[model samples]
Structure formats: structure tokens, C-alpha cells
Target: MRVRRKPNPNRNHPLHCPYCASELLFPDEETEFAWSCQDCLRVFSVQFHGQDDPPVKPEPARSSHEALANSLKRKGHEL
Candidate 1:
């Protein structure tokens, strides 16, 4: 079975400009998955993989090992 999507004019699809962090990148052709960032004046393409996986969750800034290494470095314990 296949699923169809209904278009909603008021629906907000979130996408930000990687360079300028602006949300004004409009599509030159949505079917072609091409987008243009007005703030950066750059054009880019969005690719969707076949897998229906969820968006990746953000990781922490430092893992336990990294935190331990930084702690040792501060105490003059060179590895």
C-alpha cells in the first residue's frame, strides 16, 4: 500500500540556511529538491534517503572519556 500526502498552505516546513542560520531558503524547484538561500545567496540540494528513519538526536558536547582527558590535562597529567 502507498500513502499520499495532502498539501497545506499554512503548514511550516522548517529548514535553515547553514551559512547564515536564516529560514528564508526558498525552493527553485521543490520536485527537484533544490533550494536557494537568500541570506547567503547560495543554492543547494536536499537529498532524502529511501529509509524512513527519524531525524538524528543531537549528542552532548563531550563524552565521559573526553571530559576525563580534559580533567587530567588541567592537573598536568600528560598522556
Candidate 2:
């Protein structure tokens, strides 16, 4: 039996906000498999397996890891 492996969630394609040169944030309010940039309001989808055209999505800054970690602790996630 062949066991399929799950794709790495942290692994993502290199992305940039064409407008502000800011690295586009991944995953907006719609889905976790997407990304977006607030500076230019441009959305993008990353190819996890190095295939398919990049998609787009709208995302905010607070969606980032550091910000999210802070939010989690604030909401009571033990450090």
C-alpha cells in the first residue's frame, strides 16, 4: 500500500507584490492555500508542488505569522 504524503503547509512559492515590492502575504479570508498583498491590494495563489498558474486573493497584515502568534497569545495560547 502506498501512503500519500501531505504537502508542507510552510513550503510555498516565492511571491512578491508587483506594486510595492513587499512580499505578498499568503492566504486571505477565503482559503489557506492562497495569498495576497495589502499594499497593492493584489491577490495571488502559490503553487505548492511547483505546478499550475498562481492564483490571487486579498489579504491583510494581521494574517501574518508573528502577528497571528501575538494574537493567539493575547487570546490565551500558552507560550
lDDT of 2: 0.65
Q: Using alpha carbons, what is the TM-score of model 1?
A: 0.42
- Count the clashes in each prediction: 0, 7
Q: For residue 59, what is the lDDT in candidate 2?
A: 65
Best-performing candidate as measured by TM-score: 1
User: Each prediction's Cα lDDT score?
Assistant: 0.71, 0.65
Q: What is the lDDT of candidate 1?
A: 0.71
Per-residue alpha-carbon lDDT of candidate 2 for residues 1-79, written as tens digits (9 for 90 to 100): 9886576576465567655778756556455455678777777655555555558754645757788789889999965
Tell me the spans in candidate 2 whose CA falls farther than 4 Å from its real position.
1-15, 18-20, 24-26, 50-79
Candidate 1: misplaced stretches above 4 Å? 1-14, 29-31, 52-79
Q: Model 1: which residue pairs collide?
A: none
Query: How far is each candidate from the true structure, as Cα RMSD in Å?
Result: 11.3, 18.6
